[model samples]
Target: MTPNAIAEHFDTTRQAVSKHLRILTECELVTQKQQGREIYYQLEIDKMKEIDKWLEQFRKIWETRFNQLDNLLATIKNKKNE
Candidate 1:
């Protein structure tokens, strides 16, 4: 999206959006393509996918922890009844 479009959606100044776009472009999270006078920003899908894959590892870990918590709670409830 163009800086103006993004800025309008976020209720921020175009300059701020441009600055963020610049940073993201530098970090390789976003890529820019120039067409005449307009430059369009696109997300680096591969990088996003890599991030998702990395986060998936943590999601599995959290699920295990939550399952353990549920088991512990059930055990406590059973003890209370006894």
Candidate 2:
């Protein structure tokens, strides 16, 4: 999408959207192409897959911690009942 359309959708200024687009371009998350006078940005699906892989590692860590917390809470509740 064009930067202006993205800015309108997010209720943000065009400059703000441009800043974020620059960052994403730097990260290789999005690619830009010049079509006449306007620039269009499109998602780089492979780069997003890289992000998904990175996030999955963290998701596993958080899930393990949440399971431990659930066990601790259950233990506390059982002790209270006894």
Candidate 3:
């Protein structure tokens, strides 16, 4: 999406959105193409997939913790009812 479109979804100014997009571009997480007067940005999907793969271990850990928390809450609720 163009910076304008991205800015509309954010509460900040268009310039702020552009600034972040610039950083993302610098990080090689996104790529931009110029068409006519507008520049459109797209995610570097391969980079994102690499990031997701790296984060998968942490995601599993968090999911396990959340499930344990849910089980504890359920036990508390059962104790309260009894």
Candidate that would win on lDDT: 3
lDDT tens digits, residue span 1-82, model 2:
9999889889779999999999999999999999999999999999999899989999999999999999999999999999
Q: Give the higher-TM-score candidate: 1 or 2.
A: 2
Clash counts for all predictions: 0, 0, 0
lDDT of 3 by residue, 1-82 (tens): 9999999998999999999999999989999999999999999999999999999999999999999999999999999999
- The TM-score leader among the candidates is 3
Every model's Cα RMSD, please?
3.4, 2.2, 1.9
Q: Which ten-residue region of model 2 has the weakest summed lDDT?
A: 4-13
TM-score of each: 0.66, 0.80, 0.80
Q: Worst 10-residue stretch by lDDT in candidate 1?
A: 3-12
Question: On residues 1-82, what C-alpha lDDT tens digit does candidate 1 reach at each position?
Answer: 8878788899788999999999999989999999889899999999989889989999999999999999999999999999
Residue 49, candidate 1: Cα error in Å is 0.5
lDDT of each: 0.93, 0.96, 0.97
